[model samples]
Target: MKYNKTYIFGITLVATLGGLLFGYDTAVISGAEKSIEAYLIRPLGLNSLIHGATVSSALIGCVAGGMLSGLFSNRFGRKKTLLISAILFFLSALGSGFPETLFFTKGEPSIGLLLAFNLYRIIGGVGVGLASAVSPMYISEISPAGIRGRLVSFNQFAIIFGMLVVYFVNWSIAYGQTIEWINDIGWRYMFASEAIPAALFGILLFMVPETPRYLVLSNRDEKARTVLTRINADRLRAESILFEIKQSIGRVTERSSIYSYGKVVIFIGILLSVFQQFVGINVALYYAPRIFESMGAAKDASMLQTIIMGFVNVIFTVVAILTVDKWGRKPLLITGSIGMAIGMFAISWLAYNEIIGISTLVFIIIYTASFMMSWGPICWVLISEIFPNKIRGQAVAIAVTAQWAANYLISSTYPAMMEYSGALTYGFYGLMALLSALFVWKMVPETKGKSLEEIERLWKK
Candidate 1:
């Protein structure tokens, strides 16, 4: 099939805005964590438990959003579901930024206030979950089979780009602020920064066409044909795509059951999602500032380093986009898992031996780089490709929801773990990385050049 570079790029960019919001919403909290805890939790006399809840409230929304994506995307179409997600992101940003005004009393922090703030965060979290599940699915469905791996990877690139932008924004805002200033006012601005990108996402989302698969499912044959023609620029190829979509939708409608595949595929999908989070990628992305602080760095220095990590994440994700199709998904996952394991082990050793210096930071950069080039993007690619078309949306939703839950678990527990075990916590992450390598080797099938139909057949075999 001939590809229309302009159409592909345009649609990919719009769909990838979902990734941008995903990154912005998830990582923005890192910048605000210290400040929020200091000003709101400490001054309000909240305990650590409530503090943790405040931090993880968005994650709860993520799981809910992920689970709902299947239903919404299946029912309302991918484009509309994404529109709803954008709305949620906008509201969450506004609500989270001014929770005191929205739901809390002035100059007071209580469980009630914290709950309200978390509720807002959860709304955004739901957006993240929906975006995470739907963005790549949208990209995968629209992308040409030959270039699908690379195009789908653009979603990850956007995510890292979003993370990088937020880190810079956070650093710039907090650059010269004293702890008092940051604790009092800086965090509010940090969260409010998301409103800019969220608005951009909403506007851009309206510009993209609905997925052809969605169009065909709704019996909008002429619209589907038009979209396919624009994407492939060939009448024959466009009709072929429409035919495939029809077959897939027919199978799904005929089954009329979400659990048509029984247990094994669901288990694999859920495990893939769970492992992606269990490896603690977000612990690094979400808490890099705090981790650096624990290594004896100042707040400003930590924020700067976090920005650097975000930069590295973006660069490596781009590299993954360039190389995923050529290198194949399994190889990248294997290499990433091994590299992460080694990096994590090295960081653990450095911290455990009281080597609180540049070496520890260097190891972290290596870890983040390895992950970005491998599991960070590759996992999403695999998830979008591995499931059959008939059940892909539902299966991917389950996996993504599991991922957010795992992410919440890691992020919520890290503070306590650091307080207790410090380096040992990293050692545990290292071990999980190693196990991830084993899992990839044993279970993950390479789907580099195959079409989605071909991959589904291979998996069924």
Candidate 2:
């Protein structure tokens, strides 16, 4: 039966907005961190401790959000939980931009104002955490198996596209502006800019239907049938799919334990999340300008180079979306791991010899492009669809929780590691990249073209 391509795409786009906000929230700091330090940190005479905490405070919220996602998602439906996240995003954007609103006087930074700012960031982090886990899960549950990889992969594309969008927004907001103006006034606008998309996401979400899988699991069979029918355009085909979903669990119960499928499935999901971060992708993203500066590129040139890298990331992610179903998950992951390792090792060698030039740029692009094509998107693809339906929300929460934790651990430690040795720093990430390939090659299942029910049965073995 022919699927309703237009209808399926419409909802998928709405879901991916969550991904866009996730990227925007995380990377928006890169543009505003210096200003945050200047406005909030210096005025209060706080040391680097306060400055670092203020800049990365969102991760604290992210950890809490990821930890709580399973509970929220299981108790509430996915759509409502996502709607909650959209609200969080909107509030965080406004609160982060105007922490002094209706309370502290403007331009007067006190310890209270500093704490208030961190609180707002943590709120946004919670939104990032929820969106990070739920967006892909929602996409996977709705998408047909044949095209599921591409559709879910689009969420990652949205994430990268979001970061790129923020990068441009930050640049435009700062360009030709005085540093004092930027610190005093411009940074607020950068944080506030996210409100537009968050409000848009919240409003648009109401127009899309809850996923059929979620509807079925919640025992709303008739509603599930309707959604599936709309997606499939053939009532009989929709009925068949609904029957498979019902048969998979024999009932609608999200209360089944995460260990219901045994520990291996959960472990695989967690490692996929960990490896995706431990390979040092976020380091490249969160510190692109810093990394380029370390290579002696001027400030302006580094920003331009970062933008160029963002373009490369988007292009390569598209490659993954196009090829993931056709090439299979394992192949692309393995090929990309090798590409990342070679790129990282090349950079390590160059750093060892104290080399900095266009070759460094080339290798960095190679490493990042490889990541965007493989682990960047494929990890989320696997995590979303890997677990049995009964335990998906719980499993994804645990996995995503580990992901945010590992992200914080890796990203925070990069500066210290680089101080110890740039060569060794990249060498370690390169080694992790190689091990990720081995992990995928041996353990990660190739989920290409398999229905969620079909894939679930594999764990029963």
TM-score: which candidate is best?
Answer: 1
Give the per-residue lDDT digits (tens) of candidate 1, residues 118-154: 8889999999999999999999988888899999999
lDDT (C-alpha) at residue 81 in model 2: 85
Global Cα RMSD, each model? 1.5, 1.7
lDDT of 2 by residue, 1-461 (tens): 38999999999999999999999999888778778878878877876655556667888888888988888887897888899999999999999889987365774777777778888999999999999988999999999999999999999999999999998998888888887888988889999999999999999999998888888778899999999999999999999999999987674255486787789999999899999988888888887877898998976677788888889999999999999999999999999999999999999999999999999999999999999999999999999999898888889999999999998887767766787899999998999999999999999998999999999999988
| lDDT score, candidate 1, position 140 | 91
Per candidate, the number of residue pairs that clash is 0, 0
Question: Which 10-residue window in model 1 sums to the lowest lDDT?
Answer: 256-265
With a 3 Å backbone cut-off (N, CA, C), the pairs that clash in candidate 1 are: none
The clash number for model 2 is 0
Model 1 regions lying over 4 Å from their true place? none
C-alpha TM-scores of all predictions = 0.97, 0.96
